[model samples]
Target: EHGRGPCDCAEFLVTLVERLTQRIERHWNGIDDLADDLEEAVLDEAGPEVGATLVDLRRQAIILRRYLQPQRDALRALQTGQPAWLESDDQRHLAEELDALERVVEDADAMRERMALVRDELNGQASERLNRNMYLLSILSAVFLPLGFLTGLFGINVAGLPGTGEPLAFWIFVGALVIVAALQLAVLRRMRWI
Candidate 1:
């Protein structure tokens, strides 16, 4: 039955802190779900959407941190009863609210760090996949380069190609081409390039 005084102030602070706590917990849960999705996508070799989601989560954490920090300070001030409007019981409730606010702040920082880690992991995975694709492409190009050159040289129209005059020259040319391809394969296998 204490009119608009310390008890009222304390109750208001408690309600505010409780609401803030619930909101922060909800946001934290959302971040956790996003992180789970990101981890799965990274493992599956999925595209960059996971990175975007992580960026969003980081942004959320940053905004929450900025908002929570001052609120936490204010709650701590209330706990100290600088205005002398808080009774002992009011101070206790204010202390509990301050603690909750501190927790929210910590959770915001932790979520931000987690988002950064996930972003880095996604970047590393993307880079690794790109490197692997490039490596495979380079190997294919290397294997085909000689074959392309040989075919280009022989396919050119000429007055006197060495193998053009004989009936069995076509078969012989094909056999030579097969041999060249086999040699390339064997060398690639030996070098562990394939």
Candidate 2:
């Protein structure tokens, strides 16, 4: 029903667009990865850590885009030539909101780009860490393999060293092994290999 007195047109339009923008911001500010079963399955396939962040961003983006369609349409309707959805005074409030929505869309795009860069950066760091671990393992194996063979061959009772036939021979080999291991550890420490 039409009101008898003039409605506070300015305040109503201001409140309307503000509420809409707020709703849009609540869901659109980030990427929107919805938490539906499908999204969860996708996240599971994506891997937990990076996948969660990406999914959230994706979800936010999707929600924002969905809200944005109507807002954009509203703006197009309010544009100078058309002026259909709203009158001239209402257009003032809507045009400002349209500008804000454009900025939001631009910011969302930037966020997507930033998340992509972060994923690439994290992947590179992970690879580098893996390689470093492999290199350390290789170094340790190289240092210990000969020592292991030497100790294995000499520990047998076939021949005579200082106490090969004695019960104390086992203790002597243990002591030698401890000494060799300690030397290896010292070298690794000095080289900062560990």
Candidate 3:
């Protein structure tokens, strides 16, 4: 036995990387839930970082994937009697965990997809509301169009007009406008178009 702590051997980096990979597997699964929550803002804690948290989860998942390759290879080498001491059961557990973490990757993918869909839906709803508001405003403006046209045409004509030559012209003109307005309202009501 070289007796310098098995990892202190020439394969230290390889061993360390492998061990890190196993640990990474554990946290990988946690990332999945984090991503789901981030995407849905399912929990309020995610706050403004919801998107950023999902992005981070994806980034971590990718990193974990890269580590898993070398980790599995290292484990295989150990299994083939390459390591000075390979605890099969522990390694098996680590491998199982690694396998489980793969699901996390899949879940994160699903989460991002759902989040994108939700964002699009929210945008569509907002756009629809905006369009409806614009339409109503335009309709109201259209309804007032006649008033504007009537005021502009008769307002600037102070001379040579039917009402400009008579003493009771102003009263008669007002009376005529009231009758016209009443008739317009009655017609609108009859047509159920008011």
Candidate 4:
């Protein structure tokens, strides 16, 4: 609203700044709550949902920072009476609002850093779990490799296959397979491969 006099203009600007400060603080409080929850989710549990939440929070913080920085600079200019219209007392009130705006900007920046740290930690946990699963799979494959080759070799048809003609050949081969398995287990144990 355009004011009729300098006094009216000062009052108008001060009221406007106070309202803006309140709105920014409300949004900042919401961000603070989310940051607290995100921190807890990152620290206490695997929090499968936290990754998505973090992404959303980071995006919001970035957007807030982008928008708030310019507004804060404008407020600073108003506080210094860059337009030569604000009285000294009005400038002082604007300075208080500017401080609040600056605080909101800093809080947004801090929130972004916090979300990034949580994201990095979650990624590290996922990588560790993946590595563990891969290691277990490798161990199982190692244990089965030789046994498969032995069985495959015996199954091959040949003119002089040792176990093909005898009645006890099946039992003998079974026993030999058990021995091979035991030997493999022993070697794996010795080498700490198990």
Best by TM-score: 1
> Model 4 lDDT vs. the true structure?
0.84
Query: Lowest-lDDT window of 10 residues in candidate 2?
Result: 29-38
Residues 56-94 of candidate 2: C-alpha lDDT, one tens digit per residue: 675566666666777777666657564354567776777
For model 3, how does the per-residue alpha-carbon lDDT over 81-131 read when each residue is reduced to its tens digit?
Answer: 535543554456545545544444455456556656645544565577789
- Estimate every model's Cα lDDT from 0 to 1: 0.78, 0.67, 0.58, 0.84
Off by over 4 Å in 3: 1-87, 165-194
What global local distance difference test value does model 2 have?
0.67
Of candidates 4 and 2, the better by TM-score: 4
In model 2, the runs with Cα more than 4 Å from the true position are 1-19, 29-50, 66-74, 77-80, 84-86, 128-136, 139-143, 155-163
Candidate 3: give its CA RMSD in angstroms.
6.7
Alpha-carbon shift of residue 173 in model 4 (angstroms): 3.2
